[model samples]
Target chain A: MEVEKKQQCSELLQLVIDGQATQQQRHELDEHLPKCECCRNEFELSLSIKEGLKSRLKKPNLPSELATSIQSKVLELA
Target chain B: MSVGESMPYKSKDKQRVFNKEFMPHIDAMYNFAYRLTLDEDDAKDLVQETYLKAFRFINSFEEGTNAKAWLFRILKNSFINNYRKVSKQPNKVDYQEVESYYNSESVDEKITTDLRVETVQHMIGDEITNALNSLDIDFRTVIILCDLEGFTYEEMAKILDIPIGTVRSRLHRARNLLKEKLVNYATSMGYKDKRK
Candidate 1:
């Protein structure tokens, strides 16, 4: 029974983190999280991991000439 | 016109759609391509091919729709058909192997418990990027789409041509694997596991 609840919390926690959870789902996680130490830790860790990925990674800009070159090639196809 | 049916736009309209709807997404497209190919030249070539294809098929696109998603679908398909054939890393793990491996293991407990928020917070950009790049392509892709690109599960399903359930499950498994990798990296770097 404990294992089953653990599995449910993980799935629910992810849905909450992803912003895909419904109001009910979010409320459910909020209630469950206080009682579950394992899930509370997992939730905090997952959020931090996601935050780190979004803020830390550098998104490379497109090469300067690549778009212009693609434009020219696309025109030639006409 | 319904999807898959050409709208027969005038030549000028085709060019307008190409510039107005598609050109704006070039940078995001390039970033996605680079991540998938992991090589600058190949990424450039793939983006170029995708743009040309997008132009040729502009008639199939509807104005004011999700232009980014459409462009992404084309780019993903082009990568599979073209770049995957010539990818230098030939040791690509089969998707079936990845599926079976994740299915056979209870990876959640192993990954989630050991890694701490402080350790992950201390990880630099290069460390995070390397960890992401080292994942199998399938796992890496889900993370890129969901976390970086911010695609919804339904949109991801259409883009990747998998069911929404598959997207959810794959994302769950991918995050677990990524956490496991981070845990391993932290342990190697002498970060103490307080649980031990």
Candidate 2:
């Protein structure tokens, strides 16, 4: 594939991975992926990256005392 | 007129409104602050400052609106204005330098040699977290806002006080930078793709 087409596919893959792709754009990507090995690999990699980010970055547990402290501080300012 | 000062008729009403509206979001606010500051004490202080500001300007907040987003916006602004001011070590990235390097031919060669996702696939949670935390604050902020906190691009724009287009671009760049960091980790682990 040409560099320009490859770049366009890359952008589309990002949109698809981010869940920002329009339905029509998604349909186009779906049609294109099977025909392009490079994009297919890139799409899979992007999916894995998204999954890794979402699952691995655990939310820090808010300390039990923190909530009450914040409440008191906020109320003190009230 | 400072907060908690007796406003006669409005004090009780404001307290009730403030507690009901803002208290529940303390955990979310703290988590966001923690991610941004990457320090427990700073996170706590940031949250305290955010709540104080929220209450101080409670009258400006329209009831029944998005309290969470409003608080997040205030926290973000406070971080920029206050936290960044006091911190001895600032994480400022020169975007022009990064962009020029990324667009250079040598960088293109380096990318082809350096980036391999197959090994990144095998990385564990701690490795991923470290890779993310290693990014510049601006990139990390976008990922934390969009991915971790699940803010929409529009919401992120409002919270970060950037254009929606900027939010999108930053998120894109952030994810790519993270991918690079993970790939570096994979390389250090001595994983090789025989198929390549």
TM-score of 1: 0.92
Clashing residue pairs for model 1: none
lDDT of 2 by residue, B1-196 (tens): 1224433338787788778888888888998899878888889888988988888888777666778888999998999888777776446767666555433333222343455556656778888888887887788888887777777777888888878877776676676678778778877877776666
Worst 10 residues of 2 chain B by lDDT: B101-110
- Model 1 Cα shift for residue B79 (angstroms): 1.0
Residue ranges of candidate 1 with Cα displaced over 4 Å: B88-106, B194-196
What lDDT is reached at residue A19 by model 2? 75
The list of candidate 2 runs beyond 4 A from truth reads B1-13, B88-91, B96-118
Tens-place lDDT per residue, model 1, B48-133, is 99999888888788888888888889999999899787776446556576566545435666676788888899998888888888
